[model samples]
Target: MSEVRVILHTDKRQALLREAQAEIRENQGRIPAGDFYARKLSAAWRRARGTRAYGPGEDQDDIGEFSLERFRDLPVTPRESLKAQPLRYAAVTPTEASEYYETTGTTGQPTPTPRLAEDTIWNTVSVAEAWRPLLGADERVVILLPSDVVPVADLVSGVCEYLDLAHIRAYPFATGITGWDRLEAMWRTFRPTTVFVAPGVALQFTRLLAQRGQLDELSSSVDRLACSGGGYTYTAAAGPGPSAARVGLARRTQGRPALPGGEASPGGRHCLHRPHRRTRAGRPG
Candidate 1:
């Protein structure tokens, strides 16, 4: 018989585990009840509690009173645990699971998350409902995020499909049109009324188009500019810092004001600039 020994680098390992556990707790409440991912999480919690037992040398009298509450109080759903026992935690049967998305764990392990068909539709419908006010029924939306291969991309595409909008274009950040000319061509060809882009990409586009003197052309056709993923600050390119003039230029050219502190009209067409704070993640633009 051979025996294997395991050693723990106490300080580093404990710190990493603490951080991962905190993240799991923060994300737990936000998980949608109907989601297969959430159901899997519930199952994982149950299994972890069920298998935990007191050591043999432990007091016999305390055995019955010893509750799983102590173990449950400690975070048990770290990404590592999910990765180690994926099948045990999965809510959907193998035959029923259609989509699998993986998140990189703290230790660089891939944690697989299952998704059902109805979960896809529900997510799509939710996104469409949230953005419908900003995007009119006749408008076309250009998705300037990553390609629709990942979960985020799939959700965006699904939302657009559910909306029944005529045009939905996706430009991959990696290989799609980079220059102003190419971008302008795509924008014109697609004739998108609504442009959905991340704040970082939008800022880069603003800088590039401004330099090329093509900012107006891009902004002219876009009725609504939806800033997805994150927010930005509208500051001047030169002179007395982020002056009202420069900020206005950036906002007008970008077709949407900088998020967080900016205000939008009730109808959702026009944006009003004000002293505002940055918008939080998962918040509507």
Candidate 2:
């Protein structure tokens, strides 16, 4: 019998459903892409309108006229780019934040990303809904990402806790707080059913295992391997990035672009152990 007892709080449920509904309606042509997008930006910008990031009412009125080019003038910036001074992008103060998590500093010195208490609450509920159908209580999970200060991934941990699933942590690798061999040993001992890791880290470990002639050590129990850092849906040339890791794949239609050959299909069901050629610190943008 399945032991999963997933329960979403009403506020969190409504928030997530709202986002999903909006996305579905937009994709189904019920909402005009440009005008609806402008309104969304206008709403978010309106929230952050009086912050240091936006610089006191600058670009306030032009929110409804938003265009793709308007991205250059938006008050928001990617968290990675603002890592050097993370709080500068925040609308709230440190006292209001619940915790802070730092990047692995693979490119340079680490940058800290802070989150409020409400952020964690929303995300915890969000992950439970998004991942519940794909995960089972009987399964064990191995998370290959940092968790000391509770980043977004921590919300997944919350789901694990709720479902009473065994979740093994391989955190220190991202921060160099621990080493690769330790992680390899844990994989051998735990044999996790689900593995969550960034794509770059996954490739790096693959190379290490292949060089050590231990490719077969990869767990067969794993039915789901979620690679984080999915990155931009659209590329710089205005093309979609490689859909190598779509977990909850969008609706498929004739005109819609299907995932390229050799990618994880819908349902998070996947096969691991294919050797990737590149070795990098973490997933690239």
Candidate 3:
């Protein structure tokens, strides 16, 4: 029952972060880099598992099939049974983890999503770099998403920290999550340049604002808006917004028809709080 302990050196961690950032900066968005990095991480996971984490006496892959060559194979993982209970899916033990996050589970019960610093460090670095182009270089952001262990708010806050953008995290959204009023108060005082929110909640919030005759104020206050989840139209990147404004939701973006928003769905979770691959730090289903 012994556990595997990965002692990643500081230099190696820094190197990983540097290379991840450089991958996006030097090459096309993430075409081949995503696959490349996934393989690299799989290898690292295998190495870290070593002669301890798997079981009492089980060592590394005994059959020598751990290699993951993209376009030709699947990456190595602990077991297929793990998928049935995703809340506990992880390469390391909770006690060994340097950090952790979880599902806001607005739809049902919550779940845990844990991780190590090594799994997150580069993912965090790469995300800030990826978002810099679409989200702007220095626009202050207000995250109006969940903030559980590794919720959207937490990740955006991390990206802002990495990129040096001024930002604030609103409380997690749910039926009675005592933070909408707080966010409104913050909006009045902080005047963030952009707002990141889920589509369902954003629509609800916008309706409430319109009822209070504050929609104009919101549009004028923030120059950019990023929306995640379905019910949005995706289009190629261009300067400014488009024209397909939703019914009863007239965006006050000067004369532009569409708002400066698109889907941030790298994974199923829509880490648009942020996500290159961020659900937990930067990876999720």
Give TM per candidate. Answer: 0.50, 0.55, 0.63
Q: How do the residues 177-284 of candidate 1 rate in per-residue lDDT, one tens digit apiece? A: 454456667876877766665445555665666666655555556665555431333332211112211222234425443322121111112221222221223111
| CA-only RMSD, every prediction | 16.0, 10.6, 10.8
Q: So what's the TM-score on candidate 3?
A: 0.63
What is the descending lDDT order?
3, 2, 1
Between candidates 1 and 3, which one is better according to lDDT? 3
lDDT of 3: 0.50
Candidate 3: deviation at residue 261, Å?
15
Candidate 2 has an lDDT of 0.49
lDDT of 3 by residue, 1-285 (tens): 001113235777667767767765776443574567667666654644442433234443332334445314534555444444543345556677665554543553444556566555555555566667667676878776553433455556666777777887665364465456666667788887777666555655555565665554654556555654333422111111221111122223332213222213121233232211112221222
Alpha-carbon deviation at 267 in model 1, angstroms: 27
- Where is model 2 more than 4 Å wrong at Cα? 1-43, 55-86, 103-105, 108-112, 146-152, 172-178, 230-285
User: In angstroms, how far off is 70's CA in candidate 3?
Assistant: 10
**Candidate 2: TM-score?**
0.55
